[model samples]
Every structure is written in C-alpha cells, then in structure tokens.
Target chain A: MTALTLHAPILLVALPLLGAFATPLVGKLGKGARNTLIGLIVLAVAGLAAMLAIDVFGSGGIPTVYELGGGTFTFPLSGGQVPVRILFEVDGMSAFMGLITALIALTGAFFSFSYWKERSGGNLYFSLFLMLIAGVFGMVLTGDMFNFFVFLEITSIAAASMVGFRVWLKQSQEAGFKVMAMYTLSGLFVLLAIGLLYGQYGHLNIAVLARSIQGSLTDMVALGLLLTGLAMKAGAVPMHMWAPDAYGESPAPMSAVLVVNSQASLYGLFRILFTLFGASISTGTVGWILIVLALLTIFVGVTMALIQSDLKRLVAFGAVSQIGYMLLGVGVGMAVIATRPEYGLVAMQGGIFHMINDAACVGLLFFASGVVIRAAGTRDLNQMGGLGHRMKWTSIFFAIGAVALAGVPPFNGFASKFLIYEAAFKLNPFLAVLAVLSSIMLLAVFVKAFQAAFLGPRSNTSAHVSDPSLGMMLPMAALVLVVIVFGLFPGFFVDHIVTPAAKALWLGRDAYINAVLGG
Target chain B: MNIGNLPFIVAALLVVLGLYTFLFKRNLIKLVIGITLIETGVNLFLVTLGYRTGGISPIYTFAPEAQQMVLPTPQALTLTSIVIGLATTALLLSFAVFVHRHYGTLDVRKVKELKG
Candidate 1:
C-alpha cells in the first residue's frame, strides 16, 4: 500500500485537529495567510478522506485497522487477549461517512471565506469550525467506545460554541445554552452507557465487547442508554427540540457542518445497533422503536417546518424531517435483518445513500440561504421577496436545492427516496404512503419559502440584494453539481459506494470484528 | 442490601437526583449545577467500578507482594471524564453568563427567545 493509504485514517482526523490549534497563530499573519492555511488544511483532509475511501472500497470492503501505540493491524496485546491500545477501524461505512464530512467541511470552509469577511473573531470562528470537523472525523473513525465518547464531547463543545458564535445576538446565546445543555446530557448518557458496559466487559474495545456480549440485563440497560442518547443527538423526533435552535442560530456555513455532525451521531447509532449489539439484542423490537420514531420525526418535522417564518428555522425543520427518512430506511433493514430479505439491503442502501444526498441538498440550501440572509439582511421569510431579480444564480441554486430536497424526480433525493419507497412499500404500504405524503408536504413547505423569498416583485428591503461573490457562489454551485451528478447516476454511486456501506452495516459484523480481533 | 452494593446505589441515587434537578429546576445556574451533579455521579460510578474490598493503589512500584490492587483503567477513565466534565461545565457556565447578561434573568422560562 502507498504511505498515504497506510496512515490515511489517523491523518484524516489529526491534520484538522492540528490545523484547528494552529488557526489563530496563522491568523496573526494576515487574512490572506489565514485563508491559505485553512484552505490547505481542508484540502489535505479531503485528500486523505478520498484516499481512505478508495482504499476501503477498492479492497472489496475490507476494513483498514490502524492501531495506535502499536504497529498497524496489531491485535491481541502482548500480554493480554484484549487490545489495550486505541484502534481506528475504517470500513466502507466509516469511509463513506468520512467522505460526506470532508465534502461538507471543504465546502463550508470555501463558503466561510466570504461569509465571515466582515465578521469579527474570524480566527476563533475558523478554529472552532476546524475543531468540530476533527471531532466528527474522530467520531466516525475510532474503534473504541471510550474514544467515541471523547470525540462526542469534542464535537459537542465545538458545535455548541459555533452555534453561539454570534454573541451579540440574544437568540444565539439562548440557542447555544440550550444546545450545550442537551448535548452534555446526551453525551453523559453515552458515557454512562460506556461505563456500564466496561463494568461488565472489562474492555473498552467495541469489537471485544461485541464478541462477548450476551444480552444480559446490564447490556440491555446500556443499549437503552446508547439508543436514547444517540437518537437524541441524531435529531429524532421528540428528542429533536434543540435542533432548530442550533441550526437556525449558527452561522450559515456552520449549519451545513452541523447537519453532518448529526449524521455522524446517526452513524454512531447505526454502528452500535448493527455491529456491536447486532447478534445480542432483539433487533426487531428496537427496529420497530426506531420506525416509530422515524414516523413521528417525519410527520412532526414537516408540520413544524410549514409554520416557520424564519428561513433557516424552516430549513432546519426540513433537515430534521430528512433524518426520519434515513431512520426509516435503515430501520426497515434492521427489522428484517434476521430474515435477510432481499429488499432489506435495498432499504439500507437508500438510507445510507440519502445521507450524502441530504448533505448536498440541505447544504446547498443552507449556503444559498446564507447568501440571501446576507444580501437581504434578514432571516424572516415574510420580509424577503424578489431576490430572483438580482440574484439569478442563487435563485436557481435555491430552487434546485428545494426541489431536490423535496425528492422531485431526476434529483439525488428522489433516487434514494425511491428506493426507500419501494422497499418500505413491500414491508408495509402504510409506511410508504406516509413517507410520500410527507414528501408532498415538504414540497409545499419549500414552495412557500421559495415563493416568499425569491419569486415576487422586488421588496424595498431586497433592492440592494445581489448574487454573492465567487467564494460563496462556488460552494453552492459545487453542491448543485453533486445534486445533478448523483441524481443522473444514482445506480453508479449506489453500486459502488452506497451498497458496500449498507452491507458494512447489514452483513459485515463478523468481518468488522475479525478485522479488529483477527479471528 | 449487601454492603458491597451501597456505592452503586448511592451513585444511582445521585444520578436520579441530578436528573430531578435538571428537569424541574427553573434557574439557569441551577441547571448547570444539575448537569454538574450528574457528571459527578457518573464519575463516582466510574471510580467505584474498579473498587475492591481491601485493594491497594494500582501503582506497581513499591507495592506489597501479596495484596490485591484495584483496577487502574477505571481510575484513568474517571480522571479523563473529570477533565472533560470540567471543560463542559466551564462552557455551559459561560453560556449561562451570556444568557443572563442578555436576558437579565436566569429563569429558563424567561429565556424564551428561541422557542418555536
């Protein structure tokens, strides 16, 4: 293997962390220098993610296990059977998640170039942004439970700080506090679950724990805590109260990154359910619970979004509803894991595929919203109008994002949602019907937002509004390109990356354990 | 109840009490305190996981020849948890300060600017 492939996993996480700490110092140089530094850091992280993804997917989904404090692939410590050192086990699923994070981080960094131009504390802002990226990479890459908790905290602190970055705004402060409180509580729930598992298993390694778990009372309790905590973090309904506040209050670019962060949490939840406790637990029951949560999340998120006056908050609700589709698609897979139904894998592929689709479409929407807010100087939809007159590119991009997010045909969202609808219909026609109904509602919601924001006669407030600079427009354009490409060739992506990722969760449990434990 | 289970019971009680405070408390500072209480409870639970009836320190140097030693990993984990808890508490308190400054009250009900 090339040296890049050999150390890609750790470098993917470490470079951003090192760059985060170095950002303020780099900023001391000048704006040009600071931007250069951040750009290089993000580019390097993205390159590493690509290398890692290629390696994992190219190897027929064989996971690359990197052992810290030891050589690569070291297993069964010298004196003990359990691996004591930290390990980064990057399978197809992890590589896929890493790719999503890298894409979003790169675009966010690009968008922030102009977004934070006039804002003060640009240095600290980028620093926290990079830190959040690092935390997410670590969360997705690590193989140890304790290490996951640490990265979880890292993401929590950085994300909460970023959400509250606009200290001048009282609403930002309120949102930050509420988000921090919820994040910490959920984090503690994860930590407590880890503690319970450790108390019984005497090992923090997920593979080791997975091998030995027997679904005891304590294991069940740990499972409960983990499910609740991760579900809350993933913005599932009833536990997703903090999402709109955090997403709406944060700077626009950070909103996109925040979406990826929640997906990382969702990644964690899937990892736990599929890999760690797959054989030990009654997955069907848990799957039903998730399905219920998914249905509620879908219905409530769209309904709540419909009434929002604020543009970002409305998109935030849309983002929350999107999470339900992912849960529903994967929850169906989990429900039929034992039966190994042919459609189950298709359902999983749809869910896993939707993650990237959502990232692109929602991210494009947020980026476009950022431009609109900056140009119009307000987030209220009621105050925004006729933006399309001056900002043609942004209007087109916003329309694309809205249509794609609503799962219209010939777009990335429809490609994945189609799979979900097909698979879910076979499982239960009611689920498919509800999902379709929600998609229609989502279309109406975004149409209202689009018409109110961009389609009418030029309001006095938007008289000065115009398309953003190249730095901002490029990211949205890139996302738009992704939406089109992925839409046109969903089968290509699903066949190559998405299927392997879905299979990694569906049938790669033994392979994951063996990769780490060397059975 | 067995004497051996007392620490676990106390830890659970502390966690329950902290949850009660977190759910019922109105003041922002009190909410921070509630989170801290929960962290302390979790930390205590982590430490107790390694406890033995009559164990020595986990250190190897100058250790007694025959006596048992408590597991050191849990202690290490607890210390790390404590440090992380400290960082989160500081951040939460800073946000609380900001909230108080802007809203002029720590009562959560009064901090309603972010509601749906």
Candidate 2:
C-alpha cells in the first residue's frame, strides 16, 4: 500500500548492488570492519525481503505491480490500449521465491565472513556475490522476458566466475569452462525462443503474450524451446552434465547459492507452464514430458552419485537428484489439471512445497560439504576418516543435512516428499513407485557418504581437521534449525507461502493478462 | 507471394546454419563467430516482425505523422537483445583468451581435465 512496499522488488537488487560496491570502499578503512558491514547489509536486505513477502501474502491473491519510475496509466491507441513501462509485479509466486533467495543469500553472506577471510580479494567475492543475488531478484521480479534473459546472464557469469575461485587449480578451471559453456548455450536457447515469440506476437511482456496466444503451432514451438532451455538451467537430464563438476569445484558458500539458483530455474519453468502457457497448452503432454524427465533425472543422478569417490561430487549428484523430486511434484500437478481438476490444487501444493524444502536440504548438504572440504583440505571420501570426534559440530550438521536429503521422517524433506507421493500416487501409482525407488537410492548414497567420511578409523596421514569458524558455523546451524522447524510445522509455511503460490500458478492467468495489457 | 513468410524461413535456416558451424568448429574464436551469426539471424527476424507494408520508423518528429509508424516494441527489444549479444560475445572471447593461456591451445577438444 505504501511507496516503500511498492518498490520492494527493486530494493532486493539495489541493496545488494550498493553493498557490493560499498564493501570494498569500506574495506579500505579497515579489515574486520568491512566484513561486519557486508554481513549487516545481507541481513538487512533479507529481513526487508521477508517483511515484504509477508505483506504480499496478507494482501490475498492480488498481485502488486510497481512501475519503474512511478504512475501507471493506459496508452490509448486507435481502439486498444497497452501498457508501456518497466514494471515489477509481486504476486504469491515472486514473493515466495524472493523469501527463499533472500533467506539463503543472507545465510551464505553471513557464513562467508570468516570462511573467506585471509584469502586475497574478499572484496571481489562479496561484489560478485551481491551481483548474483541481484540477478536472481531481477529474474523473479521482472515481468519482461528480455530483461529476464539479461538477469539470467548476470547470474550465470557471476556463478561461473565464482566456480573457479581457485583459479590456479587445473580441475577448477576445467569445471568452470564446462559450466560456463553450458550456461551460455542455455541462455542462447532462451534468447532464441524469446525472439521467436516476439516475432509472432510483437510483445516481449510475459503477461501480454499469455493472453494473446491461443494454441497455435508457433505457440507449441515456443513452448518446446522454452522448456528445453529452462530444463538445461534446472539441470534436467540430457542437459545436466555441468551440475556435478561445477558444484564440486565452487567454494561452499557459492555452491549453496548454485543449489538455490537451480531451484529458481525450476520455479521459472513452473511459471512458464502454469502462468505463461497454461491456457494455450494442454497439460497432458507437458506433464508427461516433465514426469519422464524427472524420473530420468532422479534415476541417473542418484546412480551416478553412488559411484562417486569425491565428497563434493557426491553432494553435487545428490543436488541433481533432489531437483527431480521438485519436478515430480510439479509434474504431478500438471498431469492432474485436466483429468482430475478437483485434485489439481493438491498436486500443485505438493510441488511448490517440495521446491522450498529441497532448496533448504540440498543447500545445507552443499554447505556441509564445503565445511568437510575446508577441514580435510580435500573432497575425496577415500582420503577422509573419523573426524566426527574432532569436528563434532560439522559432523552433526552434515548428518542432519544427510538425513533431510534422504527424506527420513521428522525432516522438512520428508514432509514435502510425503505430499508429492500422495498426489503423484493418486494420478499414477507407477510414478509414485519410481519416486520411492529413487528415494531409496538417495538414502543409500548419503549413508555411504557418512560411513566413508565420518565412521571409519581416523587416518593419521590426513591433516588434523577442525570445524569452520563461528561465522560459518552459524549459517549451517540456522539451516539445521529451519529444517527442524519446518519439518515440525510444515503446515504454517505451506498454508502461507506454497498454497497461495500454487493458486496463483494454476488459476491466475486472466489476472496476469489484465495487469500487462489492460483490456 | 506473401512477404511475411519469407523472412521467417530465412531466419530459421540461418539459425540452423549457425548451430552447425558452432557444433563442428574446433576453434574457440570460430565458435563465438557462429554464436554471433545466430544472434544476427534472431535479431533480423525480430526487426522484420515490426515491419508493415508501408510503415515508416516509429520516431515521429511531427505530431501529424504518427499514424504511419511501424510497431516499435520489437525494434526496441531487438536493440536490447543486440546489446546483450555484444556483451556475451566479449565475455566469451575473454574466456577464450584465458583458455589459451592456461591450456596453450584454442581447441575445446584438447581441454580434458573436466571430462568424466
């Protein structure tokens, strides 16, 4: 209702933008002071974003659109009117994503305080970190497709550069190259698709395109292109080759960001499917494609993780598998849209709920792996042994994360996976059965990681491993607490954030068209 | 002969050609060139979308001349897309330089430290 709340979306990017530049300038004044300031800035932005998300949820299903300069009006032309302005629209979906992105970014930035010190170019790290956060904010908040492409590039370049933080290492550089190539190629696909859409409709605004499109061959082509490109970003199988190596090579803090980044891509896919192409496209075909892809992603990702000797690579593969679960939920939702319209809501709820939990669980796993790498100075499970007694906090955190990822009871991961199974089973028990099989593989893989890294005899040849600094430990601890809290009280988050997001996604097409083109 | 259908087919062929060159090329610089060519095809298609039979540029210096304007939105979007393409091309080229310095070769096949 107020001006401050109206500009909430832009503030998500600007706060970080200002901080990225401020960190180095402030660092010039002192060493410790700069980190403290950066941490404070991250916490501030995250807190503000949380507040805005709450406001949006309380406002019911009405989406808030804020024009870049101010004052929104319709431009009359002949017999029609169109909106010509840069706008930020915060609906249930965008706010939910904003909350997830800001929360994870806050934790990562705070964790980096002690984790990145004594390394040269800390300022550079913070700058790139903020830019990455800003890019995500832009991606979720912007309504324009071309602008979305730009933000995707920003996220890609910053992430790829960060993946090779250890620029001197040959493995790191190679991993960086693979990730960069894949991300750029994906972006190019998205750009081409957007161009195709633009040529057909003469509108790049997503909301407008949604209304004007009505089940044409061009629409189908655009849909295919969009799905392929977004699938690559989400690390879907046949296009997910870069995920494991990139996650393995990046620093822990950045790896956490990458997990969340891929989740954002999934969210983008959901937005396109439900919000952009919902009316024009049939759910049956889209749902089948997603279900098959999700199945392959889970089966392949976990089987590959099982054979991995490197701890970071193992965690990376785990991330790929977790993405499958989220897709399963979304795919189930898509399948039920026409056949069982009454159960559509439940399927969507399951999918969106899984999205939030998977971000937390997979993010925690990557962070813990970073801690393991930091302590042992290697990610090889064979080189690691009983550091459980020495690094008690790290071990416990890793165990919590591992259990959550395996979808055990009394974890946030289980709550969502249970919902997904119920919904997916109702639609097709076979999908539900495959999901269970995938879950078992994930459990076995993590148990192996624990046994190899924490339960074996302590290797004297390995360096003396200790827990990360308190600054780093604090974020992991916070994540552990969230997993426990959300696991215990899943309904609160589900009812408030995920439920409304599902509604907006499933039935808000007309509202979207009205906001963009003004009939 | 409808003029609208012509540009679309041409653009599609150019994109296919660009992809072929990119996939087959061994040199990093040549790969980048392939990407640029593909972008050019996309951009040209975008500009052509705004075209009308007798429409002029969207810019109207005189108030009375506004009725003859072509659709300006696609043109604006294309300009933005082109600029983005330029930035990507620049970044990829610099990355190629980094690759050259590290591996002592511009061939992507020679870079194997990341392969399974």
Candidate 3:
C-alpha cells in the first residue's frame, strides 16, 4: 500500500484535527470565504473517508489495523514481549460510521452557511464542528479503550459547546450544561471500566483485553458500568431524559450531526459486546437486557413524542425512538446468536442498516424543521401553520422525511424496519408485534407533526415567510435524494454494506483479535 | 481489613460519594465538583492498580536498584485520566460560570427553560 493509503485511518482523524485548529486562521478571510473553506474542508474529508471505507470494504471486508505513531509492535513489556499498543482498528462497521458522519457533517456544514451566517462566534462554530467530526471518527476507529474514552470526552465537549451556541438563549446554556454533566459522568464510568480491565490484564488494548477477559465478578461490574454509561450516551430510556434536552436545544444542523453522535455510542457498545466480551460473556443474558431496554426506549420515545407540541422536541423524541429499532435488531441478534446464528446475523444486519437510515432520515427531518424555524421564526407547532403554501420545497422535504421516517412503503425506514421486525419475530413473535405497533405510533406521531407544523392555513406569525434560500434548500434536497435512493435500492445496500457490517461485528471477532495480537 | 485493599476501598468510596453528590445535588457548582471527585477516584483506582508489593520506580533508564516494579501502564493511564479530568472539569466549570452569568443562580432546577 502507498504511504497515504496505509495511513488512511490516522489521516481521517488528524486531517480534521488540523482543520479544526487551522480554521480560525482561515476564518479571517470573512464570512463568505470562511464558509466556503469550511464547506470544502468537510466535503474533502467526506471524500477521503468514503475512499478509505470503499478500500477497506473492497479488500474482502476484513478488519484493517493501523498501529498509531508508526510502529507494528503492540506494546514493549519488560520481558521484551509486546502485550498492547495504541492502534486504529477499522473494519466495515467503523467505515460505515465514518461514512455516515462525513455525509451528515458535510450536510450540516453546508446547511450552517444559511443557518448561522449572521451569528457571532462563527469562528468557534467551525472549529468545534471540525473537532467534533475528528473526535467522533477517533471514537469509532480507535483500537484502545482509553483512547475511546478520550475521544468520547472530546466529542461531548464539542457537542455541548455547539448545543450552547445560542448562549443568549438561557435554555441553550442549560442544555449545554446538562449534556456536559452527562458526558463527564459517563466518561468516568467508562474510564473506571477500563481501569478494571487493565488491572486484570495489564493491557488496555481491546484485542488483548478481549483475549484475556475472564467475565468474572470484576468483569461483570466493569460490564455493568460500561453498559449503563454507554446506554445513557445512546439515550436509551430510563436515563434518556437528557437526550431530548440536548438534541432539541441545539441548532438544526448541529442536531442533524448529533444523531450520528448518539449512534456512535451504540456502535461502541456493540463493538465491546461482540468483540471484547464475545464468547467470554453469556450472550443470552446480555441480549435479553438489551431487548428489554430497546422495548422501553421504543415505547417511551413514541409516548413522549405524542405529547410534545414543540416541533424540535417532537422530532427529538422521534430520534430517540429510531434508536430502538437499531438496538432491538442488534439486541435480538445477540440474544439468539449462541443458538440460531443465521437469525442473529440477519438481526444485526437489520440493526446496522437502520443506523445509516436513521442518520439520514433524522438528519433530513432536523434540517427541515430548522428551515421551518428559520423561515417562520418559531419552533412551536401551535404557532406554525400553512407554511406549505410559501415554503414549497421546504414543505416537500419535510413531507418526504416524515413519511420516510414513519416507515411508509418505498422508504428506507420501511426496508430496515422490515428486516428488524422479521428477524425479531424469528426470535419471538411478540417483539415483532411491538416493533410494528411502535413504528405505527411513530407514523402517527410524525403525522401529527406534519399536520401541526406544515399543513394548516398560514398563521399570522408566518405570513411573511416564504421559500428559504438555495443554500438551505440544497442540503434538504440532497437529503431528499438520499431518502429516495436508499428507499429505492434498499436491497443493494443490505447486501453490499449492511451484511458485511454485521458480519464484521458477529463473525470478525477472531480476525480483530488476531490483527493486533498476531502482529 | 487488610491495608492492601485500603486504597481501593477508599477509591470506591470516593466514587460513590461523587455519584451521590452528582445525582442529588441541586447546585451546578456542586455537580461539577462531584464529577471531579469521581474522576479523582477513578484516577486513584488506576494508580492503585499499578501498585506492586515491593515495587520501585518504573523508570528503567536509571536502572533502579529495586527489581520488582509496580505496573507502569496504570500509572500512565492515571496520568492520561488526570489530564482528561482537567479538561472536562475546566469545560464544565466554564459552562457553570456561563450558567451563573446567564441565570444569576447556580440552581439546576432554576435552569430549566428547556424542559418538556
């Protein structure tokens, strides 16, 4: 491999880190120039990440390991044997997230041009945006547990700052603080878990630790902390109270990207479960607990969304519910993997596919809602009415996103949700029933949102609103295309992308362990 | 009752105390302090993990006279955690200062303009 190709994983992270710090200097070029630079930077990163992803996915879909700071040795122990080292391990799943993050982040940056054009602290906005991207990439790709924690902190800190971007708004600051508190506590819990593992094995590298994990009481305790903390980050119910606050309070574009951030935590959970603890832990019990959490998350998010009148809050709840489909699919997969391997693989495929679909559909919805808020200057559904007449394209985008998210036919949501519902039924018929009913509730919830926010006669407050500018409409249009393409060709994605990703999680454990250990 | 477990027990207690204060406290400042305490506790546990019965300094460059060395990895982990703890603590504190500047109070209950 060429040096550039050999270093794709590190470049994926470092390029963004460089851009994050360097953007302030670039921002001196003025708003229009600054925005163009930021857009170009994100777009470039997206292309590079997509290239790396396709390369890895093309190469027989195996785990690709990159030892960080240029070395192949795992760790230099006192006996001259290597136990562990800092590394970036990229597989189908990591590539999947990197691609999704890049896509959504690029969209978020493009949309921000129109969304935050006149806002102050635009320099800080670009810096944090890049840093958030870098942090998330690091989190998903890192091979070591401690590096994951460090990256998690970076992502949360950047996300909290972005959430508090509207510092003039009191609730924005509150949301920022709330997110920060949750992130800090979660980081510590994760760190403590890492400590337990390290104390037992003297290695923090996931592959080494996974090889050595005994699943003892200490392991169970560490697993408990990891599960709880990662679940909280994923916004699973019971501790999901913080999700709406943070997701709803952020600007629309930031909210779009935040969807992927939530998914990254779920990704971490899956990685540790299937790779780190796989074959070591009792998969049956872990899967059942996840299933329980998934059901609660699905029900609670839908029920909560039903009562929300604020447009952003409604979609935030919808986002939370979408996470259930993913967890339900993967949870069922894990639950049954030890018994029925085929069903488990299919379940995981469904969940993994759902992650990308959820990111796109939710991102489109958030951007559309942002468009409505921007044009009509309100997020309250009660106050927003009949913008469909003036904002034609925006309304169309919103309708497409709403239908797609609700699992209507010919939409990507239906495709993945179908896989999940079918696989879940194989596990147990009741899960399928609940999954179907919950999705129907999601449809009802968004239909209400559509009726309240986009349907009625134009209210007095929105009388002057019209179609948003091209800069805003373009991103929405791009998402509309994504929704359509994915919907139309779900089978293609399922075979090429989704199945390989699930395989990487379920079947690639040994390959992953060997990549670091064998070297 | 053995003294070997004392540091670990103390670390666990610190963590529990921090979680209690973090979850139950009303004041934002107190909540931030709680997070710092938990981080410190975690750092302590990490350092404790590296402790060997008769270990000397892990620095091999000087070739210390003592042979049995405590694990150096946890100490490295602890140092990284401490650095990260500093960052999170600083970020949270700044946010707290911003909260006070915005709302004129440190009470979290009073800061709920975003609640459902």
Model 3 DockQ (Cα-based) = 0.77
By lDDT, is 1 or 3 better?
1
Tell me the tens digit of each residue's lDDT in model 2 across A1-519: 676786788888788878777878888887678877877778877876887788888988777776667565632112356546666777788888888898789888887777787778787788778878888888888877777887888888878877865666677776776687678777877877787787777677778777677778877888888898888888998678889888888887788788778877787788888888885788988998999999899889999999999998898898898888878888878887877877667878877887777777777887888777777777789887887767888889988988887789899988888888888888889988988888888899999998877776767743477787887888889999889998999988889888888888888766666665554
Weakest lDDT window of 10 consecutive positions for candidate 1 chain A: A72-81
The C-alpha stretches of model 1 lying farther than 4 A from their native spots are: A72-80, B1-3
Highest lDDT: give the candidate number.
1
Model 2's TM-score against the true structure: 0.94
Scoring each candidate complex against the real one, what DockQ results? 0.84, 0.44, 0.77
Per-residue lDDT of model 1, residues A1-519, tens digit only: 697887888888899899899999999998889999999999999999999999999999778888876764354333335677888999999999999999999999999999999889999999999999999999999999999999999999999999997788989999999999999999998999999999998999888888888899999999999999999999999999999999999998999999999999999999999999987899789888989999999999999999999999999999999999999999999998887679999999999999999999999999999898888888999888998999999999999999999999999999999999998898899999999999999999999999988899877877887898998989889999999999999999999999999999999998888887776
List clashing residue pairs in candidate 1: none
lDDT of 1 by residue, B39-115 (tens): 98899999999988789998899998999899999998999999999989999899999999999999998998877
**C-alpha positional error of residue A414 in candidate 2 after TM-score superposition, expressed in Å:** 0.4
Which CAPRI category fits model 2?
A: acceptable
Between the candidate structures 2 and 3, which one is better when assessed by TM-score?
A: 3
